[model samples]
Target: MSDGFSSFAKLFSGYYSDKLGKRKEIATFGYVATGIFPAIIAISMSWTVVLIGRIFGWMGRGIRGPPLDAILAKSIQEKGFRKAFGMHRAGDTLGAMVGPALAFVLVIRIGIRDIIWLAMIPGISLQ
Candidate 1:
């Protein structure tokens, strides 16, 4: 599953991030990958295509995790780490809640495929 690939990607991505010293670029690439891949499923006509898209999307998420955390830690002072992380987590939680709620509403109006495409808009715009 995607989790397995994600775990594999995490192990190597951390090493590459350190070597490349380009956390921002790496994270951006990861975010773009995560954003674009799942949207591929919207065009899929088969379950296999859906599976591939999901796996790649999740791997992208895993790829971004460590580098993004490193960037976050570096951006904030040591004393403010707790608050910064709290706020970051709060934003993530809000997104998690809002995304599903929006999807639930939109799915009725736009249907599942269109909703997935709509979801990609925000993800791709993160850059």
Candidate 2:
């Protein structure tokens, strides 16, 4: 359902980042924006709020993706570019795997409120 936002954000945000010459700032904002609303989702008292937060969070990711990719490509050597991107993909996949497993364990022990807060650590660190 939110895939549309991701697609649009990927396109437009990439354009915006390129035009503004603020790759770092835009990328960081996108990443930080993603980090924030999960906590909001965790704490929100209503479904509407959850949905809104979810949309915004996905948008941030869409915005962040292209800038990060551009920066990453620029930072690496041509010969090792594939390797660098492969590593980046692997890290992203690993985080996806680890995050849910960690959350499952933590949710059982610490409860939702606390787990959500604990889950927010890396996002805050990213910001």
Candidate 3:
């Protein structure tokens, strides 16, 4: 499942992002998926459901990475490219740092299944 997700994400996300010119959407989707899927897993009583959610979430992330970088690069000034990329990278890392801890808490309180619904938070903003 992991391998399948990895392969699918790499190819499909890139393709769709390019075709749609929606890298930002991909990135947003990726983040939302991360937020929601783990929450679902934390809430879910079954491992099978968690696995399914993880696969879907991972694919969103995989699709998001390249297009995000590209879009971010395009959106910024050439002279400030380094700084811009740096800030984005930093923010992404920070989000990663916070997400797991938050997930831990959310899972403890609400379980993983319900937590997955939170993924819609960012996704909603995207539209």
Candidate 4:
């Protein structure tokens, strides 16, 4: 993957997501794409396909990040920006804390493929 494309895609996606005022939608789309792309990568045999999927997945993150922050800001209002951001960070860290446990469970019980499929649930529900 090219660093240039990744950076550019993320920069533009963040710009557009902000411009469009669709923060929630962007956040939901990012989640769904993340879930689906990993599955695509797992199923693919070719390196090219896996690379493309990874690139797209990163782009999907670009698509989501600003909008997710934007929504959180809006939800909390301008005066609460600091608190809102703090809450977001806290929630993110909490998720990070659980990730390893979840991965272990997936590897031992359901497998990676199932985990990928399961990931979609949050995205789909968020949407």
State TM-scores per candidate. Answer: 0.93, 0.92, 0.68, 0.77
True-structure lDDT of candidate 3: 0.74
Candidate 3 stretches greater than 4 Å from native: 1-4, 19-45, 105-120
Candidate 1 root-mean-square deviation in Å: 1.2
| Tens-place lDDT digits, model 1, residues 29-119 | 8898889997889999999999999999989988998888889999989999999999999999999999899899989998999988876
Off by over 4 Å in 2: none
Candidate 4 per-residue lDDT over residues 1-127, each given as its tens digit: 5345556666765787788876677777777776567766777789898788777766666667777776676677678888879888998899888976787777888787676667656656755
Pairs of residues at least 3 apart in sequence or in different chains that clash in candidate 4 = none
Better lDDT candidate (1, 4): 1
Best by TM-score: 1
For candidate 4, the 10 contiguous residues with the lowest summed lDDT are 1-10
TM-score-better candidate, 2 vs 4: 2
Better of 3 and 4 by lDDT: 3
lDDT over C-alpha atoms for residue 109 of model 4: 86
Candidates ranked, most accurate by TM-score first: 1, 2, 4, 3
Q: List lDDT for all candidates, in order.
A: 0.88, 0.85, 0.74, 0.72
Residue range 63-126, candidate 3, lDDT tens digits: 6777887887888889999999889889989989997789789999986655566655675565
